[model samples]
Target: MPERTETSPAHHGHQRSPGREQLETATTVFALLADPTRLHLLWLLAGGEADVTELASESEAARPAVSQHLAKLRLAGLVQARKDGRRMVYSLRDGHLRRLVTEALSHADHQVTGAPWHA
Candidate 1:
């Protein structure tokens, strides 16, 4: 078996530790996620891609507010947008982000519901 190192994931796995640049980038991603509206937008996108109108309607955040939040997320590279006819559809840029948003919400659910944490 491979010996665990400081860089390993969960302190006992094989994943490498994030370097300084990666840490800064992750910090920026976390900062963007700090906003409730932005997080909601991301959570919605985790389900699948959607255009602005659909997102605004589902989130009930207003068309303009959703657009602004999407702009920030797009600029941060957490999400991507593409023109679908006349509408701009958005989606999580990668599976990693989708999983991250899903896991974050799952963690929040545990805290709010007083559920036991899983290993």
Candidate 2:
């Protein structure tokens, strides 16, 4: 894999163009949430942690399908898993992720409804 580099221009003591970082981060997070299965998985985890079987049942998706989405979320660092006896329970890694998702959704809703979240 190519070595990841910080592409954004730097400032005095902080990264410049935070909007750029927000957009990039939002894009990645949105991409992860794009799939219905993954979204459902997130919703489930929003309530609490669950294993593959639990998530599959809650999402009404096949085990492999749920596992696939979980893998992607894990790879994205959006979700973390812990072995609970024989099952691996997954949960959202960052509390900010929930806010990010909520804010993005609110923005979209506002755009469609012509009631912007920001003035």
Candidate 3:
């Protein structure tokens, strides 16, 4: 066992490039996520794959709205869908994206509810 730190100094050596391309791309993804409904959908998908009906029921949004959000998320490369027989099951496309959404919502919860933040 060893002492733990929030971040290791060696990790900073792998920082992403400062090129505008990454910034612009991230901005586009954030723009797509601006809607609450879409963000909720992403949160659900981050947990695991689910069909539109489950998402709608859990999120309390209309089925059509959930479908539309899933479509947009799929198009934005944030999520993926596959036909499980007649049903289309959806999930996050990248593992990094799952953590990104989870971390963001956790941070928001802390801010909205005045909970203590943890790294």
Candidate 4:
């Protein structure tokens, strides 16, 4: 394990607590990400904004499904959409989430390739 630095809390932050509501909200978000389609949608949005047609084509999911997934993500405050004429352009709402999706995918790649995990 990596050594804890001055910035690091000696123990898990959870030990100090973020309050039940905050933790529950986080778990709910994680539950949303547990869905493969939803996770894919997030990963795609992290790259940049795209419309439903583009996201459907790139994700290889049905257009309706992509829209539905986007709706769920949007409601969760994970993504944002803006009207671009008749099209709705979507993107990840923050850089932290972008990095989270990227790191998760990288970890997934390591698992699939039997690569050793690194900290």
Best model per TM-score: 1
Q: How far does residue 94 in candidate 2 sit from its true spot (Å)?
A: 1.7
**How many angstroms is residue 115 displaced in model 3 relative to the true structure, after the best TM-score fit?**
1.3
- C-alpha lDDT (0 to 100) for residue 6 of candidate 1: 70
Instruction: Report the C-alpha lDDT of model 2 over 1-119, residue by residue, as the tens digit.
Output: 34435642342234444688778986898888888788878878877889999999989999999999999999999999999888899998876776566655667789899984663
Please, what are the lDDT tens digits per residue for candidate 1 over residues 46-115?
Answer: 9999998999998888999999999999988999999988999999998878877888999999999999
Clashing pairs in 2: none
For candidate 3, give the lDDT of residue 60.
Answer: 100
Q: How accurate is candidate 2 locally (lDDT)?
A: 0.81
lDDT string, candidate 4, 4-99, tens digits: 665574453334546799879879888989999889989988889999999999999999999999999999999999999999999999886787
In Å, residue 60's CA in model 2 sits off its true spot by 0.4
lDDT of 3 by residue, 67-105 (tens): 988888888888889999999999899877787788889
Best by lDDT: 1
What range of 10 consecutive residues in model 2 has the weakest lDDT sum?
8-17
Tell me how many clashing residue pairs each candidate has: 0, 0, 0, 0
In model 1, where do residues sit more than 4 Å from their true spots? 1-14
TM-score of 4: 0.85
TM-score for each model: 0.88, 0.69, 0.85, 0.85
